[model samples]
Target: MCRWLAYSGTPILLDELLYKTEHSLIDQSMHSKLGVETTNGDGVGVGWYEAGEQPVPALFRGIGPAWGDVNLRELARVTRSGLFLAHIRASTGTPVQQTNCHPFRYGRWLWCHNGAIHEFRELRRDLMMAIDPDLFPSISGSTDSEVMFYLALTFGLREEPVRAVERMAGFVEQVAKAHGVAEPMQMTVGTTDGDRVWAFRYSSVGKSRTLFYSTELNALRTMHPELEVLRGLSEETRLIVSEPLGELKGAWQPVPESSYGVIQKGADELGSFTPR
Candidate 1:
């Protein structure tokens, strides 16, 4: 498994979430309490959309432990984004390489996953075959995470993210069941297209990995009026992560199991998720 985070709202340096928090993503890369593995050192990646009319997000990925990556630290200190994704990888089985890192991108979208397709080797060929031919050539890594991204794209992620993901999950299970894999999927996926973000938590066995979203900014502001950080953020600011970034009281809420949420400019939404 892996540890990842998605942030949207007030523009701020990436380090605010990557390094400044009590238990930041960089800290989780070394001492994760919620992930299956304590150290997610295989690789690290960050993707973010620049302020303005840029259609695609920028990416910085490296095949090295995030905690020791000076390049990543330097970049995080200087770069700011209103919307971004950061991930620290712990390879399930695939080779640890830059291309295999998370925050996979295509056109105006960005995606990252923190779980696996059980028996991916057994299901790889079928899964790969299912991707649209035009999209298949865009797959640059061998991780099931990247394949899942392309699969979602093939199923129409651009038009309907939640439904496309549901279909992607359904299709993976459909292929896995045919290969006799009992527990076919485990995932906590996050995706965005510069303007909005969507996150999902689900698994075939009904025991998915941990995922949490930050409490509403207004509520947090009221609860911790003394905190300086809370004052700078907008009401629309939101964060979804594999674990709580800090121990601030009432600062985090668990995303319900087998459910999904959407964060946008107006009112955000949390709803039930059912695979097709």
Candidate 2:
């Protein structure tokens, strides 16, 4: 339902992934080839933690298409971070408002999601009631995407992201099944606390939303030998996106269904899970 990306390697201007590529996030905002929609105009956001910052990531969001937002263009051109999260939304039923945008922030954690809570209207109240009251008030958006974040927080994302997410997914599947809905969740999530980024490609069904991570820099460089920028970035530099940035074969690899990817400096690891 949306397109997103997370970078956890060399720090570069946001535009390098958000706008400059042959099929960057900006391009996917209006011309997505692998999304349900060609144009994702509801809203967009970006969050990045510069080195030395207190894990509280800086975020900028707007309820406008990415291509027409001059401010986002300017921000992308100037900002750089080793880890970045950017999303272009296609709101399933939520209103187009800045607060409803992705890259939602809370303390040191930043999160973004690219799918929906199936038949959300049926479980909105139930899910809301389940969020910790203290954290519930912090939720500023009406999107299920944000609620999912809060749910993960309730399950202990701050202290244990992997377990928290699995618990949250299990709870969601439980609630959905009670309403006679099967596979009521679909999501490709990116979350970080400045030091490491954890991304999940999952759904209640065996099949999940689209998510891909870049091949190792050394390997990708071998394929496109002329792309000079690859040489400057560290071998640890990696990118995870909702879709391939270009027709660059061997440049990206699909995150296996129902799996979570942990991107840390110098190494990438994946953990498999069954969402309830």
Candidate 3:
């Protein structure tokens, strides 16, 4: 279980989301209300796409807690990105290590996940063998979270993200059922390729992980005029997070269960999927 966020829109400093909100991601690092754990202190990570460059993303991950990390604070104050993924980890069975952090990257795609694979130890070896050997060595950590990233890649994430994820979930469920592990896999993942962003709120049980996305900017501006940060952001800029960052009532919208939402540079879209 973890608390995470995905931002896709106008370029803005990381502090705008990481440190500024009343109940920001940094705040959730210590006082999360919706996650499986109240405090996600295992580790934290951030990944963002640089503006006007290639689509590939750069990452910054540390084994330290998000609230206490000095480097995170300094970086938040200076770094800005139009597409970002930030995560606070609560390790289930895996050890807390740098490679285990979220916002895993491969080529042009950036990804993060919030949830765990049921009976990870039992299925770890089987699933690892399924990944393409070329990509397996790049998986530096032993967390089931990171393995899911490579699984999506093995199923073709680079070519078709939506289908890749669906197939990966299908494989996980299949492996779980064969082992008599009836519990469903839970996942609320966000991924992007610099031009478009996709967020998924899904679980095999149909009661998925908690996730949210922001409403249109014009409406927020109309509602809260005094908010100075709103002036710097564009009309198309949007944010998706595991929980509401602030007390602004209608500012956040819950992503429908079993749905995948897409935010391109110019348009927004959502589609449905059935988790097998």
Candidate number with greatest TM-score: 1
- Give RMSD to native, each candidate: 0.7, 1.2, 1.3
lDDT of candidate 1 at residue 264, scale 0 to 100: 96
TM-score of candidate 3 relative to the true fold: 0.96
Reference-based lDDT, each prediction: 0.95, 0.89, 0.88
TM-score of each: 0.99, 0.96, 0.96
Candidate with more favorable, higher TM-score: 1 or 2: 1
Model 1, backbone clash pairs (residues 3+ apart or across chains), number: 0
Q: Write model 3 residue lDDT over 108-149, tens digit each, in one string.
A: 878889998888899888889999989977888888878888
Clash list (residue pairs), candidate 1: none
User: Which ten residues in a row are the worst by lDDT in model 2?
Assistant: 267-276
- lDDT winner between 1 and 3, please give it: 1
What is the overall TM-score of model 1 with all chains considered together?
0.99
Residue 189 displacement (Å), model 3: 0.7
Q: State the displacement of the C-alpha of residue 199, model 2, in Å, after optimal TM-score superposition.
A: 1.0
Clashes of each: 0, 0, 0
